[model samples]
Target: MSAALLAALTATTPAAAAPPHWTIAPSAGGGSRPAAQDGRPYIYAEGAPGSVLEDKVAVTNPSAEPLTVAVRGAGAPDVRTKAKGPGAWLTFATRSVKIPARTRAEIPFTVTVPAGATPGDHPGAIVASGGGRTSGISVHLRVSGPTLSALTVEHVRVEGGDRIAYEVVNRGNTTLTPRLAVRADGLFGGVLDKGPRTLPVELPPGRRVRLTEPWHGAPALDAVDVKVTVTAGGGAGDSATATARFVPWGPLGGALAVLAGGAFAAYASVRRRRRKGPGPGTGNPRSAP
Candidate 1:
């Protein structure tokens, strides 16, 4: 062969093989898990607003020899690793992970939910590159808002006169303006007290408040029922019901006399019934009377 032709052929020819080697399995991580072979892998997380999620990556060495895997890019400033020494989110930590022949290792990356974080879905990935070879995996994450709120009314009681008091609370993230409705029945007859009274209050994130309403006119007798409703922006609203005992007022002496008379009447009625007992029973008397 000519010298020039031989040089060109050598340059174009492929290099000789060294030894038998193991081949990496395609889709070894089942397409769901992220795997790092020659280079870095990427993953994703999804969370709600003010929520957190985590993504993981695995490195596998298919060869017969032990493989030393060094993890990096987690602490990088531009990287979004939610790790902190204390009270931090989206954190990641890993030492030199050694995967023995036909073995694998794991590395985790966490994504923290941010306070006042906007509501939406976010996408991120972890790049795992090493050993002169590279591979990438993707991460998916989502964030959402407050689902619902629980409201309760407790200890509703009527004071000395016709005054009523109860408690109102907002167990939600958003502020609330509760509309209260009072209804009383039983001895006082059916009556409805409806008002669009604004509470003139702002409840911020996990707070409670006490409310009192007074009823004029005749004192309530027997049981009194109160129904309360709460409404707020974003079409968030709730309702609750509470009951109180209403006491009637009268002259002290007169009230005492009435109670005594009622008790005496009840006792007399019981005695009369006992005396008239077994009237129609045909039984053997002690001595035929």
Candidate 2:
């Protein structure tokens, strides 16, 4: 085979031929009665403001070789790049651990809720990275207080005459599953009306997502006012509107060409009249004398 063919095959091959076989999950209850509690799929905790909660995560290595893993919290706090949610509240005793083959290590962690933390579900995850692979176990932390769900629709507009774009913001302290409805009014009457439908997105508290809706049936020539309404559970809803104008340029261009041709002909007639130099019966004093 050619050298180029050999190089191509080498490039397509993966660096790691063996698949990683390790797992991370929430630890079962600790102490003498460790088997007294049932197995947990994820970590769950609830506390009042200014409280400290404890939990444990387990990492298991089934491979023949020892495995070293790095652990950290992700999600909520990383959403807006600020330390305000449960992701930032996590504090592990040790962030790294090593386990011998066929062994499991349980690590303890603490979640310290701030004094002014809001009340709602602050979903996060404890992630383990090892052996060129990673695993994450979810953490559902809720603060004890009244909860609220509110959202807003903003920046609604049409794009490329075929898509409607907008932004949805979760303004409350609770996660929201939003539904969207679209309506457009034109010069003559309503041009487009799409009923409410669930958006394939879950808006976490204090986060915004930009989404687009298909507008394949948009009019070719009309001035339209598009209104977008978004609503979520718990009486959270808001609406925004934008205006767009569409013109059938193909037909307009033909009419403009005809007008241009007529203007050019009128100009030619004026030029020819000027060149004829005052035809028949036109008065000239020197010629009359």
Candidate 3:
């Protein structure tokens, strides 16, 4: 056998491979429930727009082997894309850490809220990544703003009996549990008068949701104007209106037809009486003679 051929037979080919992402799932520090009762693998912090808050996060490694991970703060991924909020404001002590097998590490961090920060929830994440694999703990940050409720109802319309469709907008910086009071008025008087009832919704700031309200049996024949008034926590409230016309066209047409027939009969009776009178005189002049 040739030397070159023997070398080729023993040669081994390499396969493509990449590193994996890893991180520890965040939990409450005390192992008890969070203050806000939000059960998420996240760091929750609240502060004013021009303030700074401090907190510590524990990163655990349940793996059997030793590993070195890069710990950093990254922008929280929004429903649409990455958020450019609190993530940009977080500052960490160390950028990387080496952990032994089956151990945990505690890292302290501070969040500095900008004076001009928007008053609302700003999300971010603390990521631990190595060998291409990445894991993250969510950061829920709320910047303090005026404690006010602001809500508005829009695009209100009556679909049918008791079925009112409307859109509610949250124009405040907090989550709201809204209530609705639907009232309807007709040409004669009020038809529906429903007081405020708690809505089955949780509206986040700057969000809009469409909902329907029920009415058992609405007016059968009348022109109605519907008004939907909504209110919520923080004194947030607004009103909107819609119009509906419900008439029994079948009965109306029949009644008009009967009146027209009666007028025709009266006209025939008058014509018969005129024909019996004298032609030129047009009246009964000495009829007996």
Q: TM-score of every model?
A: 0.37, 0.82, 0.55
lDDT of 2 by residue, 1-289 (tens): 1122223322322345664488887888631123334577567788998999888888888988998988987654634336565667889989999889999999999988888777877777777777776667767677889989899888999999999999999888777889999999999999989999998887777888899999988999999999999999999999999999999899999999999999999999999999988977787656465
List the candidate 3 regions with Cα displacement exceeding 4 Å: 1-26, 30-43, 50-112, 120-140, 160-162, 248-289
Give candidates' CA RMSD values in order.
Answer: 23.3, 7.9, 14.1
Highest-lDDT candidate: 2
lDDT of 3 at 185: 96
- Candidate 3: give its CA RMSD in angstroms: 14.1
Model 3 quality (TM-score): 0.55
Error of 2 at 266 (Å): 1.5
Tens digits of lDDT, candidate 3, 1-289: 1123223432333436633223465544622236445544567788887898887666666777776777777653322223355667878778777777788887777888888777766556676665445556666677787655687899998885558999998877666889989899999999999999998776656668899888777888989999999999777899999999887778988998999999999999999988887567555558575
| Clash count, predicted structure 2 | 0
Q: Report, for every candidate in turn, its global Cα lDDT versus the true structure.
A: 0.50, 0.81, 0.72
